[model samples]
Target: IRQTFPSAYFIELTVRQAHYAIESTERLPPAHLITWVLPDYIQFPFLGGGSNGFSIGVIPFAIIILALVLAPSRKLFSFLALYLIPLGFTLSIPPFSWINNYLPPFSHMRGNLRWMVSAAFPLACLAAASIETFIEKGIAGREKIMRRTARGVAVFVIVLVFVTLASQFLAPRLIGNEDFMGKLVDFHFRGRTATLPASHYLEVAESAVRDIGNQLSFANAWWVIAILMWVGAGGFFYFIARWRPTSKTVLMLIAGAMTVNVFAVFSYQYHNFIPQEIMLQTPALVNFLKDHEPNPRRYRIMGFLIGDGMFREVLVHSPMPPQELANMERELLVNNTSVFWEIQRMDGLEPYRTLRHNQLLNTLINADKAGYIFDRENPNVRALTLDRVDNRDALRSVTPQEKIKDFLLQLPLLSMMNVKYIYSLYPLQDPRLTPITIPRPASIPVNIYLYKNTQVLPRIYFAERPLFSKNQGTEFLLEIAEVNDFRHTTVIECNDCVARPVGRGQPPKFVINEYRDGLLSVNTETTADEWLVFSESAMPGWVATVDGVPAKIYTANYLFQAIQVPPGKHQIEWRYEDIFMQKQKALLEYLEKLFR
Candidate 1:
């Protein structure tokens, strides 16, 4: 069929046919295609046009532009060049970003946000120049309308600049105020430390950095994009106003294009947004500033000058675990010395050459068995800080008790620290404590009650009954003394005002019972029958037995129980199946009334 026409014309017609077919397949209306397609070829790359087609069209246009330029007035062309240079530079280059590194941390953003912020002012100036050029060109003539439309684009670019700037300021402020960051950081630090993972700090820092990045990208970036679209709309108006030469036509074209672009950008961002972490510092403080509505379960109290405090403060305040407890024992038993003091202690000792000894030292120091030796008055104490016990070199001649005692004596000033007594208790079965035998002293009285290996010495011991069913296996009598006078006492009280007796006889009633909300209530009448009343939440999981006899369970109207109190508390022992939540101690006569 193409034989009837010239070869070049036939080829052109075939290409046109193919192009129309593609345009139809894409559902583009003919009018839309006509407006978007170039006479040569300059389709958007992603939409199908490649660089070859784009260059073919651009080169011809460039040639024509040059021809027109040669014929134009020199002054007019210079003005145009002057206007274009600033426009191109402003759009492509960021000015303020050069100094962004030194800016205040007003937002939670880290790297790129700063760059965007610094560029905001320069971008605005560019937009202003473009808008000024468009207004001066006017929207009457078709050529003038196109110029105005181009100028309006400056408005959109400037608006975007402002939005980005605002985000730079707002993001940090918002990120700094979130509650989850603090809670998360607190959880990460405390949980990791409590578990005593050696690599905790590295893991935490990595996690924090990740969270900061996520927050910057997700929460703050979109606002900048939105502002950019508005400024872009003005630019569109300036161009359309010039292209069509009618005010109404320019307005409609610009409005429609702006709306579509803005909505498209917003929708794309919303759908394509990648999830990221928000970096936070002083999370707890930020949470408080937000009026504390995020979480209602925990009660929070802020002190007059100290800031917000809560029961959870215990967890936050002591993010570091009891390092003292772990360190003390590791040093005492594991011949491991302090890694911190390696340089100070081994400065000139050239006993070993291989790094093998150093590695061995590290392993021993980290383990649980290397015991330390210290001298009280000497500023420098000597012991194997990093060497483990030499099992092969053990002397069969030395008794275990003697070895234990030697270990105890090797520790620094135990008696002065009151930790020396820990030595007399020989052979503690638990991993945490070591035991040494204390010889019976003539002048000092000794009362020995062994607690089961599993039961830790609680901070508070109920004096009422130190013995519980859980005390089944082995026991040790806990020695109590007055902190001020060092006098031995039989009674102990927990900080919460609960009391118990531990000595040889019955502890005197520390406080008289008085009921305020209801009538007087008692578990079992104080009739010559001995019974002790206890507040209970439910059937106490563990029931104490005296001499293998189950004590009667008495329920109080207020959900308390009265157990039969053995007369004179003559060493009638009782034990519980479960551990007590708080320690009980005998309340001193003077202290009991004062507290009640």
Candidate 2:
């Protein structure tokens, strides 16, 4: 919003985005780092279409491919058969559950190593079918050519794997040199401090390793079972060669595993390949409502999937429009996105004061207490899907419009799939209801009433535009309180306030929540105009002088003060020693004292 809606005084931020900013901040003055950070173009190990996870899985398959090509013509079919057996077994295993667990919904891509593994057999089949046909024709020269080609491909695969592994290790140092790993670690850690030293990249690496070890150990256990099947099947093939076992026997064992493994790999990698996403979940509900099998498109329209029994039966029996059937996937994506945006909007309001409660608003004015409202359990929005909403439950449900008046409130980005739909259907006007035009191709407008007054009347506007455009017939009006001198009161010690994932107001600082004895004690509120500042004990001049009269100040390795009192209302502020945040227990100690 700061970048796009510059005229608006409001600013917005997210925890992840804030961390990213901090990561980038270390290298500042873009021109200095621009030429060094990125080159004109990168070449090698095409990451264009594949997920990072899928690329990892391609290593073993590439080796198998080469082995198949080099094997003698007489043994080629057996080698090929052995190569494919694991895939079929993989297909039989439901791997999608694991994959879904590995991948969070907001993940950028769906392709992974399992996908590569899934494709391996099909490619192998193509190669074998071609090679088998060639050998039957007795193309003697072609055999040598194929063998050499296979070896080359295998070499390429090995090289790709080595390079990929190297890049993972080299990336931190290469990108940011001495500070790279620290920055990456800091970015991931967000505002949280580690128990160990912040300078230790090894700790960061160890933590990451631990996390991956846990997840992959679970995932690869299945791979191990699959490999055991490979060993058994491979041994059977080896024995058949010696004992003159029937070709049909060898073929069935190899072919069955080959076919089954695809599903297994797909399931394991994709988390069951059953499409457990929210968009797909509505089908069960739709089928329940229809009482007969609904078409695939009907499930799509319904926005999620239902279970297999009643829902599946209903979908099977109901008359589904061929076009709607075709577009089921698209609709599911949109509905889910809408649901996520609503969650974010609701979550955003909790950290800020609502104008509806004068006491809370006054608390904000004095800085004595900051009010926050937890509307409900907010959905963990990883990525927004494609969806349009005629209304949002979060915005309209509030009694007073002023509660939703903050323009900088939560707005999430909608998925690209939904944006395309909204943009294509521009000027989507419905006169029967208060029509708020949805300009984007993929997202629908959340027509929300933000504020109300007797004279101003209620009005509506779009909560978020999924697909942004320069010429979207949009103009913004910013309302800054005209009264420059907002009244406030001061307190000797004030600590209560709302703290959350803020983007760009100020870097987070420690606070003290002063309370006395068994009963809670301390200032209830502080005026916006007053400063409740804390200082390190090291600050020789740092002392609390209420009305310029010296008072005995408590210091926990730092001095603290509440200053600049206008008298109506004010809260205590804690100012840290300049170097407090950079090192040691200074900041932590300050918070401990305040909260104590």
Candidate 3:
């Protein structure tokens, strides 16, 4: 957080690891998709990548992109409107991302795809402008460019379809005689699981492709479809060529029929989207823990997917749930499958503490990742280590590595934070882990397993004294605390905590009075000064009042909340106040109301 980089959008916690924001292959051209329903996009929810992995905003995208190439005049405006603006947000390069890196709304953007989505309107307008210019004043020499362009577009699209259909017709013979699923299974992927077999989802998905077979075999119908598109384009252009009272009606009919054709082609693209909150299926373990007597302890899950925008229960410690993040990333990043985990929310996840809470959350993780954690940044993948000193900002690389070493290297800190369980897709055979036996659910393609740690402590505990350090980084704290039993002696540099009274007149007595999402009340009886620590992500908003008087809330254990209380019976209450989240919620509500 000390300085910013040009590629800040790529590494921003909220939008990082999100596939759609970083990858723009999905929005390339309509030529890539059989479904041609190109919807206009003005804001986030840019899940352009669809079942085809290239589906989002195809229609308008194709129109905008093609207009730039096909149209002659107003090229700079077209370039700025269609190319510069959209890419300025999506690309991390100098000339492209200049606006995003400098602009206020663009800075700390929720996702890059949202920027591209913003360009959609301007690009559409550019296309419209070109159409109007051509219809009214026509390009010099190429006066019939509009009519020619329409006919050319139809022929080009028909050829593209013919090529695509040809590929399907010959795929079986060229690739393999086996069924499509068989070929897919045999192909190796690029990341850690690349050697591992393809997910069953791939098989199930490829099986669902509408025209997987030789569309050429149905050549008669294919030709008819192509003819219809050509006729429609020809008729639209034909009417524009001459003004008449009937032209408007004829254009409307052609446009309506074309819309139906496009919709029919991609009818199934949107047949399967259910909002995550409404489609809640609580994890079995989550349900069990919620029902258990000792339900105060929080746990973390890690596996094939961590934070799904549609599934909130999967990730703890994060104010924004998986589904919530997904909705944001998919829309804003324009990648439906991408998930965002933004660690630096200006709106507080919790109350502001007596101490400043400006630190980013990524410094704590020790990820040995595969795909996104490319090896180029850290050449020796085995030696890829994340430390607070550097924030180990290597999580944005796209180069696929076979395996990421010790993705959960922060287990020591997590244990101290009261992470009781680890839900992982692969077996974590690390020394500190113990497998929790459970029937693997059929929902996920990979085998989902759970592991437990015996060393993790309770959510609330009394620490002997704060281990002071000049470096308040997460990795540094863990390194210092590991020497002693971290449960009793944790590290922090906050000046609010001092050692317990020398004589220790009497061990401090701790009792919980009341607890809620944003509030904690504790009754403490202590004859000696002691530090009372609560396991939770700390921020500036969490203030403490001991015996109805204000006290400093220390940033304890590198990431938790704590306050020192004097030797006496006292009621210590902590209240949470997050204005950012409030504003975000209010804005979201207003937006929903406006849209609704």
Candidate 4:
């Protein structure tokens, strides 16, 4: 892990700091995090209804409370539950907040609600122990009243479980009905019509209706199948209870109930399953992009789908149908779909990125937010538009004009990263970007416009002049972003390395001999010593060799690899190899040979 991510420690520290800051700003009330007995009313309305808005649900809460009251090992289980569940929540409170401030490892933890996940095991154990104790006590005792009460309690629990299962199966179908949805719309929109004009109100209402209907339709289907499941559970429970069943028979009944419960939940969760063939079907836009840029390694593409935080705020609140939203999310090459298309993409959903790369991206995003516009005529000079207003209000209002104004693509930084093609649902108004005509796919509701970055740099280039930066913070990132001639000037993050002036000579000729995953070879002939900058991310474990001799790799342009070369034809090879990878390769080879 250390070999793969040289800056892993730094990245972790930075991420922890960022996470803490975000958590501080978006801190939930202590009661919200600690209230495991109640269902989250804001998130799970259906479940929350049973708790009278105090907890998640009454059924689950009752079981937990019963376990606390009746468990044989109540003290130990209670201690574990109380300690684990509240540990994360208390970080936000006073005395415990000191742990977050002083303790480095503990401070790094985020997502306070996740602690409840760990507490689940103890809770489950407690509940099981309580139930077992109840049964054992009733069987061992001589009193008829106690035995009768235990049997009654057991029967009640069995009935409740089956009833809950039936509800799970039936609720999806009943809620999905059009009439029911209309009622829901009415309930939500009650007393709000007086604030808006008649036309606008109608538009909003229609959009809301469609959105809710689409969500229900997508979430649940196969009403007949659900009905069958409900009937099956009810019939099985009835037959089992009616007969004087043996121990084996009762066990089978319990096992069947467990299996059905699992099946119902799994089926409901994965109801949105599309066939493999349908999911992997290449979109027309992807085909177009592939045809134009045959070699994905040379350049990258970015899709302005509803993925970016700012962009999502505008599009999500724009009263779009849920189907349209789903199409945009699944169909667009936003996250990892670029991998399937065999095309390089800069923007992706990743757990963590290199500190420098993340900083550069954040800097560009901030610049766009601030309305910092780069000159179309001269790439070096940039202008800030103070007249630009914040789109927060516009997003809330959700007009077409406002939606368009919300996004200012960071074209300059994107160009530096070798981003050639940018596709978006809405057209971008940038002078530097030229629009390309492509027929929109019929399935897609919105029009997708492709823009060609005119100022995109080559994947590999030589720079005679080197701008050395002592600082590796936001200041350095800003300096890198402000560079006009990225191809001619390279920014090196090194305090000791000597800065070289721009040499007066013809540019060096270079040929990419070979390029593949984890390996790159290039032949270059330069008139003078210059820095060879590769647009690939400068990650750890990547070793460079100049004519079979080891050479140092320096970080360039805040995120790429840069190495110095003298005036001669040299074969430079870069291979990413780590101890863990080598061991895995050896193990695989051994296994293959042994099998043979």
Q: Of the candidates shown, which would achieve the greatest TM-score relative to the real structure?
A: 4
Off by over 4 Å in 4: 1-10, 13-67, 74-110, 116-120, 139-260, 308-326, 366-409, 497-503, 579-596
Model 3 lDDT, residue 291, Cα: 53
Can you write out model 1's per-residue Cα lDDT over 1-596, one digit (the tens) per residue? 23332332322212122222212122122222221112212122112321111111211222223333333444445544554443332222234222222232211112231232333344333333333333344423445534554564465456545544564565455455445445544654563323223334334434444433443242544434434444544555454444554546644553454355436445644643432321211222223323522422111111110111111122222222334323222222112221222211111111221122222222211111222211222332122221222211111223334334444332221111112123122233434243322233222122121211111221111223321211110011011111211112112222232333434443334222332221222222121324343322213333545445666554321122344554432222223432222112223555787888
Count backbone overlaps in model 2.
94
- lDDT, candidate 2, 1-596, per-residue tens: 32333211211211112122212222112222111111111111111222211221221233234444444454555545554443333232235433322333312122222333554455555445544443344332343443444455445445534544554565444444445546666765687544334544444444443333332232345534443443443343344334544445544654555455545555554642333353434332232323432321111111111111212322333434434432343332332332332211111122231121111112111111111221223352112210111101111122212222221121110110011111111122222113222222122111211111111100110111111112110010001111121111111221332222323232212223442211111232332222333321223223344434443443210112223333332233232322322223567788899999
lDDT ranking of the models: 4, 3, 1, 2
Clash count for candidate 1 is 76
Q: What are the per-residue Cα lDDT tens digits for candidate 4 across 1-596?
A: 74544333344524344334224322444444423422222222221111111332222333334445544465546644555445444345655455654465555555554444555555545544443443444321324433343454455445534644565565556455656655655675676433234444344445554433342232334333333443454444344445535545644654565465446545654644544655566777778877887788888877663353224344534744544544555567655676787877676543354545544443343222222222223333233211112212111232344334443445567777898887776668878789998877666656678888898888888865778888645456557767876755678888788865545487788999999988889999988787888888887668889999999999888788988888889999888887466567789999999999
Q: Between 2 and 4, whose TM-score is larger?
A: 4
Off by over 4 Å in 2: 1-207, 215-220, 244-246, 266-596
After superposition, candidate 3 runs with Cα above 4 Å error: 1-84, 91-94, 102-105, 126-154, 165-231, 238-245, 274-278, 293-411, 428-436, 442-446, 472-484, 495-505, 579-596
Model 1 segments more than 4 A misplaced: 1-98, 102-109, 115-129, 138-244, 270-596
| lDDT score, candidate 2 | 0.29
RMSD, each candidate, Å? 30.2, 25.6, 10.7, 9.7
Alpha carbon lDDT of each predicted model: 0.30, 0.29, 0.48, 0.56
- Against the hidden reference, what TM-scores do the models get? 0.20, 0.27, 0.62, 0.66
Ranking by TM-score: 4, 3, 2, 1
